[model samples]
Target chain A: MSPKGPAPSSVVREFIKDIVVDNRFCFSFPAETSALNKSVASFGVINPVWIVKSQDNRKTIVSGFRRYNAARKAGLETIPALTFKAGREYDLFIAHVAENTAVRKLNVGEISRVIFCANEHFGHGFEKISDRLFDALGLERSRKIYDMLLAVAGYGPAAKDIVSAGMSLKAAYRLARFEPDQRETLCKWIMDNRYGTSKSSLMIDMIDDIQAVKKKSVDEIIADAEAHVSPDMEKPQRSSRLFESVATMRNPILARMRRDFQTALESLNLPPSVEVIPPNNFEGRHIEFVIRARDRSSAISSFKALSKVAEAESENTESSKLSGLFGWI
Target chain B: MSFPGFSKILIAEEAVSTPLTKKAKAAWPDIAPQIVRNLADHELQLDMEPDPVAAGKRTLALGPNRGKFIRKCPGTMGLVCCNYWVIDLVEGCPIDCSYCILQGYLTDRRIRLATNINDLVDEIDAELAGGTQPVRVGTGELSDSLILDPQLGLAETLIDIFRTRPRATLELKTKTANIDSLLNLEPADNIVIGWSVNTPAIISSDERGASNLHDRLAAARQIVKHGWKVAFHFDPLVLHDRWEEGYRRVVDDIFSVAPPEKVAWISLGAFRFHPSLKQVIRDRFPMSDILNSEFVLCPDNKMRYVKPERLKLFRTLKNAIVAKAPSTPLYLCMEGIEIWESVFGGSPRGDKNLCQVFG
Candidate 1:
């Protein structure tokens, strides 16, 4: 539709006609269109239809495969669209993105494509591209771009299936922080039923370890990563059932220090978390201490005493390392 | 807008009207109520509180410099005002921006609405009264310049104050539609009215309680229509989803409202936060995805985008801004020397400042 043409109102809906996907401006489905159609039927089209005017003047769908399929499934001949004057395929792709992602939802892949194409097309960084898009969209959509980037990094590609395909902004941001290779791997892993969202963070941590130690050998990186994995994130190796019978004595060093702090409190018997240890590990960070008490006054008193002890310990520990270590001992 | 979490207040018994003040009242009335309420809310203990200004202070000092001290703004070669001079004004803003550093740095969480305008003027007058070189200054370093315009009429008074001294110019940076206090003022080539802007998301999530981006652009248009030199800022440019579209919209919107020739200058700053304030901001804006960007520590220990990332953002923003405001002076805030060299291709200077381009 040309800018000079009349805008689509409720009445214009009747005049709107169905168009095919064989136009010069159209692109193919990245995945299964039928499945996408099913998803859209069950969920809904998250992003709008990207269309371009065919030589014959029919508005042809350029993007939004799911939307097109859903429309087909619904036996609809036409869909809502604002046609673009297409030139460069990349530019058209970006325009398609700006049209929908501005106010609607997009997957990390779609967002990354636009950002990547923006740099490739306009020759700029994600920040400038983001700002430029922000200014163009009037700021609201620009904020979504920031969130999308975080999603891609945090969730990786599996996020595309679990989050982006469904258009969950929160999940996208959580996935964006992971390395691209890891994202793809985890995505496949999730697809193959090896892991789920519950194990997502653990997978991401393993990826982070690999990335951190990339300069070392792959074996070294994996070993280091394996050593650091909390028992929760990694499956413990079973020694033919011999290791299962050994009486386990698990003692958190920090918990021991915390117990000492509680003993010092005496009648102050504070909550397990409130007793502050010396600032050996958690220095310069505000800690959340829950002081469960019989009453508010005792809680208050325990808080005061804990604060005093923490403050004194922090100072003493800073001045003398030996005392700091010994204090904990 | 009501300044939430405000505990301390200072009342200004004196009613002063300058052109800038009148303009501000006409621009944003929401700000006036908060400013006026703050003045009435606090106890007037004395004629003046101690100026807690300190020499060689860090960048994260909250408002209320305990002592009156003079320090140069570490502004680079070509920018207008020194950033440090403005830091001495007030801390804590009532306006919320998801990207605002105050979200992280300001512990008090209340608007430290500074009422010691007289003392500030006196100190500025004494310092720059006979200084040999021209001194560039602004009030937006700590708080929104016109947030208190209705009650204090600060811009008008400051414009009038600066009229006597041609060497110094006061730039009031804001994201509000507060131009009334500035419209009627005798247009001073020296006094620059700047508006901080970003993608719509920046305004919505980062700049909560502030005017929408369109309103700000409209306000800038009003200023230019009234024959005042204007400026725009994309400071704390956040990396967000569809950021390209967002920034493009901002640039196009600005051009539609005010011609490039009407602009004095434009600034581009990538999102940078103090280490201490990151958690605060995260807690305050739990849904904000800004904290998840690829960040590296600067020499100041503040978290900023990597140099490559900064350069990339700078280049993209600069190219688009220059398309319309080609001749308008552009600079970066709190960026390093290498970035300046890489992005703009040359160092910026005072003669190269916005005043030189549009003054």
Candidate 2:
């Protein structure tokens, strides 16, 4: 292909079967096609997909793979596409990535694909291309991010899907450090439970602690009855319970402290209007007393009641016990 | 130090024509200096890179120490703080330790070498004159005191200032063997030169660009030969396989080089960092096994080894040091009173006792 103007007006109508969906260009976990199909059916593809002709006289969709799939599903016989002269492979990859990124923010899986595809086409000198590629793709220009995205791309398609769903880039990078089967099981569990980004991160830490400290296999840890998901609970409830159980098992001392705090609070047996709140993680010296009093008189009465309760509790409880409850130990 | 050293030197315009800036320019005569309007301009130039670590390595910024140069060490709340005073002459360190808290503590990576040494000296003199109680003052809290000492010669100036003061001691702490500038100076009873030492394995693996364990001990030996009190900090002590043997070797190396009475104090602190430093470590040093160990978030919001693990490491190391030099005072840095009591059978409780140990 000879050099031409930068922006070529080469829109053409091509048969649906003639356009190929390159796996490199398509998102691993695409959005639902029905909505796009409905839109294309009603509005008739407003924007033409970008494409490049191959040596075999076939066209490859550089961008808009989702739109092509949606158009095909909508029973359209043909679609509009703007073909660019196939220049250097690097340029083609950049154009494809730029078009897709311009359309919407790329997810973790798509970002991984772009990085790997760029590397394959550009032939390894990441130091030269990382800054430019990151800038063009609207990614943080960091070697750390580049390395992580590459590792995330190394995962199988299923794991990539899980990452695209909601798992954070950091969590995916951490999971990539594990063995393939372990990584898959962990990712699948996270996906099945619909764990949000933060929960997924916590889950990863829990698994890491279990493997490192307890010397248990990821499979064994997940298969334990303590981690078993209750059938009657909703997804959020199941995830919350599983997270709590994992945290409790991971830090038994902390769990014991929390349990002791609860026991201490219950032993006080304060009225509902007067509540005692322990510090976060029971790691502070002060316990807050929150009293819901209606007026000044009520406030005075609540304070008097609190004083009485404190005196009685002090008389009953040893200083060491109270100090331990307050994290003085 | 791995990267190219300081491609461009940026001097604050406000600091132009000052003696410190002139000294900085003279220190590196080969590299022409560029005078920016202010430190803000220098920072703006640094912000151009998306990731500034590399750029920061190649750029050097010299500015006045606008903030209070002499301030209390912001020790973690609820922990037994040893009321140490800090003299921050620099903002960042050149030697990169994988587990360094400065990686997260500093906002930028540029080596902000403060050229306003006169103001720092004035502040310290004022602080010492105001109080009769002896105070332990150090310059290694923000950056290593001697990494750039060959160029700036701040150590000599600081030593000269502290030698005359009766109520304060100047502690020059470092991980490098950059003590050539201070070897020939007059020995001050109040001046203590401290070295941050770790196991040989950790020195090779994590402490990039720092002097190795052998060289640091040799440097301490040189300082002690001059009748200057020396201290050692086994800070951020990492636990690895055969760690006991590794740490035992370090303790033995310390006693072999420096005499027991000449040693001022030995401080032990296990690896601890803010929670955010965990990700930074993983990103920067992927192969480091430091984070793989068990860590719990303490009340101060820093991640540390759990109580039992910390107690075990401290007690073992303490016993080793005591066996070698029973008279040398040992203290724990930034540790809770409970751990202190567990390890030492009592707590320092306040700064007065801690200062008295050194006194």
The DockQ scores of all candidates, in the order shown, are 0.01, 0.18
| Candidate with best DockQ | 2
Off by over 4 Å in 1: A1-329, B1-66, B69-71, B74-84, B87-89, B104-109, B349-359
TM-score for all predictions?
Answer: 0.46, 0.78
lDDT value for model 1: 0.56
Report every candidate's CA lDDT.
Answer: 0.56, 0.77
Give me the displacement of residue A60 in model 1, in angstroms: 80
Top lDDT hit: 2
Model 2 residue A268 CA deviation in Å: 6.0
lDDT by residue (tens digit), candidate 1, A1-329: 46532232221221124655633323231444677677766665544565655567675566665576676686665555655554445456545556665666545455544554456555666466665554443333333455454345344435556543443344445445455665565555444433445444334333432343233332344344334444343333421111111101011233454455445545334456464344333222233345667888877877786776667667776553224333332
Model 1 over residues B30-145: C-alpha lDDT tens digits? 43332343342332221111211110011111123345634565554423332435535556566766566655444343444343456666787788765566566777876788
Cα deviation of B351, candidate 2, in Å:
6.3
Task: Give the TM-score comparing model 2 with the true structure, all chains together.
Answer: 0.78
TM-score of chain A of 1: 0.43
